[model samples]
Target: MSRHFETAPGLCEARDTATNAYVFNQTMLRIKDPERTLDFYTRVLGMTLVKKLPFPKMEFTLYFLAAIPDSQLEQWSKDDGERLAQTFGRPAMLELTYNWGDKDKAEVNYHNGNSEPKGFGHIGFAVPDLAAACARFDSLGVTYVKRPEDGKMNNIAFIQDPDGYWIEIFSPENLEQGLSEHLGSDQDQR
Candidate 1:
């Protein structure tokens, strides 16, 4: 199967119909301590643990989490491999992998990709109210890479997980309003 689309005048772009059929499945992050990371994600961030795959022989475990209810995940778990694939055809999830004995050993730590030269930037979530979320994080003692009040980008803030990976937080309304106010004036010059 093929589709022909036009990029501009006299430009015929052809592509296989199956070429772009893709969906974001999951983002995997290595964790040093399962208990502490799980507590941070579940208790502080309000995410539900959907699935757990433990490979004792391989000496590692994979935990899939989402902002979904347990009942919904239970229903999805009833499906077989093929059925599950079909059902979750476009599922977006977070996978946390923990190596065995890392929690017991104090010297084990993963590079958070935010050192001298940054690699992976950050993952983001849009909250209902940014102020309330930051307040709750303060009470929970979550580490902040950039607090809303501490930076020039006051609309968006960055918080670090137990593993030192940054999670960007913002409210959709605030972000959009800020972007509109800032970017709207630039159109006049164009």
Candidate 2:
């Protein structure tokens, strides 16, 4: 179905002509350093790695990490894949296959982020104690980007990784309200 729409720099959105409307469906993200990124997602964000598929020729690994719902595990195990995802991924269940290194060098997961004359704005990581996390970063000489602040958030802060990529240290709870606010209307966060 060639729906000739303005294509973003990344992959084109698949479509259906019968409805002539944008459909929300599964999103597959490709990333570099899938293992490291997967570890970060699971450890720092409390996600569980439910699946792993490695492609040596592609020098990449696909990891599916989902934040389980409060429902009984028996029920989820009995549910269909599509249903499980719909119930859980609505707010978030972002997936990725980070290649960190392909063949000799990994392909970029263009979806990661793009900065104007700079690096990614930042990716948030959940931490128990902002101060303690900051201290650890300090010990490793990770550049301090910002002191933890309320930011209208329960607690959050910014930091720069060794590669100069911006990182946000935040609690999962802090995002609940902000997310709802963004969904409410056209509020320019940027």
Candidate 3:
């Protein structure tokens, strides 16, 4: 199907010709241990569980989570969910798909797209305070791929989840200021 977007001034909206609308609802990640993954996302990252859909026939469960509270999504239908997904500056919803047998087998592993071909790069999160977030992650024993102090991109940092997927943390103000100061007038030239 063909996809189109309507752009007016500063706003942009994605639309589908046939369907009612097209939204980037969620990014699905196949997780081995749901308990550990849920803890990492909820406790460490402070995401709320918005919806949980279980498929007994398919032998899998889908957990939808976002930074917003569950109360906000209580009345949201499928269309509302799609509209919510289109919102920018709001935390993107995460869909964790857990296969029923993975936990039982203990040997099933999901490729985090970091090795070999490296298809998926990383997911990013914008925080109000980057330093505090990094510090908290440190206290939680989260694995760091790159710290803000380690590289030229001092405003951004990357952390790895238990599944090895990289999560980038940054502040919008920090990124703007850092890039401007780092680049100076040479930004336009580059």
Predicted model with the maximum lDDT: 1
Q: Candidate 3: where is the Cα deviation over 4 Å?
A: 1-20, 69-91, 180-190
User: Which predicted model would earn the best TM-score?
Assistant: 1
lDDT of 2 by residue, 1-190 (tens): 5556544356556755676643443346555555555655555445665556677887667666666544633444434565555444444445566563542454333532446555446656677666777677667555556766545443567765323445678667556655565453324433
> Predictions ranked by TM-score, top down?
1, 3, 2
Candidate 3 versus truth, CA RMSD in Å, comes to 6.5
For candidate 1, the lDDT comes to 0.80
RMSD of 2: 9.1
- Summing lDDT over every window of 10 consecutive residues in candidate 2, give the lowest-scoring window: 103-112
What would you estimate as the lDDT of candidate 2? 0.56
Ranking according to lDDT, highest score first: 1, 3, 2
All candidates: TM-score: 0.78, 0.45, 0.74
The Cα local distance difference test for each model comes to: 0.80, 0.56, 0.79
Positional deviation of 114 in candidate 3, in angstroms? 2.3
